[model samples]
Target: MNYMDDFPMLNKDIVYFDNGATTLKPKSVIKAMDDYYLNYSSNAHRGDYKISLKVNDAYEGVREKVKKLINAKSSNEIVFTSGSTDSLNMIVYGYFKNKLNKDDEVLVTKSEHASNILPWYELSNEMGININYIPLTENHTVTLDNVIKSITPKTKVISIAHVTNVIGDVRPIKEIIEYAHKNNILVVIDGAQSVGHIKVDVQDMDIDFLAFSAHKMLGPTGVGVLYGKYDLLNELIPTRYGGGMNISFTSKDEIEYKELPYKLEAGTQNIAGVIGLGAAIDYINNVGINNIEETCDSLKEYIISGLKSIPHIKVYNENVEGSIVTFNVKDVFAQDTAIYLDKYNICVRSGSHCAKKLEDELGIKNTCRISIYFYNTKEDADKLINALKNENILEESLGV
Candidate 1:
């Protein structure tokens, strides 16, 4: 079956360019979730009943799927969380609570999404660790030189986004990871915007920890993967504790915890969501991530060229090689531009996009961002540009 054809929202006339925020799910994913609720909707890893066993197996299968998706060393390294935000927080709080001390530093960049930055900031505040910013170049890409200069003996962790959500600049994670590891610093990557859009090999990159949301890859929301090195994960403690993650409990003394992934995942998981994520991974594997990347690259090129041809428009990070295009048109407010484009059945994201610090660093209040996925085509790009060209006329006539 054609994967794009299975998306319910694609049948509508609206052009979807806000894929960075979330993606529309395919029918297979929906069917997978439906099958769970209809047939074997039981709590996972808690009961030995047949339905519960089936749920447990299906839920655990997703761990293997995610490990393969990112080329992780083992399925035991993958932990399920609510989403990227939860995963990042878990790692930050769990690791830093024991690892960092007063005057110790956590290095990050100005281009990070709030999900990656805020958790580290809060950790630093509570633990008395110093948060240091790795400065970006004029083109908005982080350089190894800046990273090298920022690192001091006190730096214990280097947390960064694999790709900037606002500018779409991909980070040099391999180089950064190698550099950090040489200095005995741990690297945590926020992969929320990078995982589905490009090929990611956590083992090859030697990333200590990484987090990505499944919904961004056309899976269900409230489901995400956190991949950590086996040895490192074995050493860290769980930020969340409850059923399904513990080994044994004593009334008077300490409780032993389960190993690796189970130790990190507490309570009842979103079994249906995990099953749907496995299906989504199957769909992506069939389509091929390289093919998806190339398709979006072509669409991004088309969008950047078209937007540049329009008068009084400034595209952010024009040279960056990613599927997103962020820009501001003339004197129009980013929200106003998005509102005007809505009349043409065009959908785009506007405002700070949860990267307020990055926006402030760039000295822009807001921008309109058009993020494309593999299913998008040149026709969508044309519609966006045409609508943008006629935005003023549409706005004036509508008395806006």
Candidate 2:
């Protein structure tokens, strides 16, 4: 019940509402990292020493945990990358390299984060494939109709975010996946926002690929997961190659690469981060993701309602449903609001939040975003609302 008790950072009396950006790690996750460094901190899968074996086992164990977390068919389907951006780039490059031609198209939605959008944009430019955009509804939600309208015979891939980071709108992923499958188009989901907050089943959803970051889910940074079907993953060429990924090498003419996940994971892997992510997964399991979802959503509803009551404030994506509440006070800059909130030990995010295209489309320069996680309480929401209500921007800025 007392989730905050498990996070050392929460004890500082700071109201942390920036879960969409990254979550504060739990004590168990921190301890997991500490234990790794203290005990078996060795290069994984390289040497025959006992420490190497232990470290390798610990690193591989996180793959199993991730497999279970997303209900993937096998651990081999998961590839470790630097972060969601790395994973997205890998998917875009590896999957589309030989398949796409000059006239081919890659469909992506406007709601996509920059990580998801830019990689494909670059790929399309390099490969001479036309990049097609799926228009968002007036409410900024992507619908099946838009998918249907966007996909043509030349469409080879459809990439979109599972959840829109700006509006907090959950896309109809299953339906989109089904449509893509019917059209023989690969579906790559930017699961960076969705994985930690919602239940994800790669098999059930029939998604070709999904990308997520560990840091957003109470895990360490520099660790990300890319889940693809085993056969598809095998078909994807290695975007990066080096030590620990090759099975054998003979002179300058011959080389044999390792298996699925390892082939994608080049160089020395993030062993400690992966281990900490495993612990974070275990922590989420104990807390029950469903319960976390309900708790955060309840808090979001409460906060958004309170924000709406403020006359001069305009809440972006008020109709969208999720744990993020984006708004701006009248005659106040978004960054100024964030700065003022920081004085009360409140942490919130401002600006375009890495979705430059979405912000441009909406004509919003920036918006203050309050993102909640399972650890946030209704009391925290109350504090945020009360702080906003009590503060006068003119007075605060001028010391009047």
lDDT of 1 by residue, 246-334 (tens): 99998648789898889888888888889999999988888899998999988899889998998878898789988889998888888
lDDT by residue (214-284, candidate 2, tens digit) is 99999999999999999888988998889878988987678999988888888988889999999999999
What root-mean-square deviation over C-alphas does model 2 reach? 1.4
Q: Determine which window of 10 residues in candidate 2 has minimal summed lDDT.
A: 391-400
Q: State candidate 1's TM-score.
A: 0.97
Full-model lDDT, candidate 2:
0.88
Q: Residue 126 deviation, candidate 1, in Å? A: 1.1
Question: What does the lDDT read for residue 42 in candidate 2?
Answer: 88
How does each model score on lDDT? Answer: 0.87, 0.88
Model 1, runs deviating above 4 Å: 1-4, 391-400
Q: What is the lDDT of residue 377 in candidate 1?
A: 77
Q: How many clashes does the backbone of model 2 have? A: 0
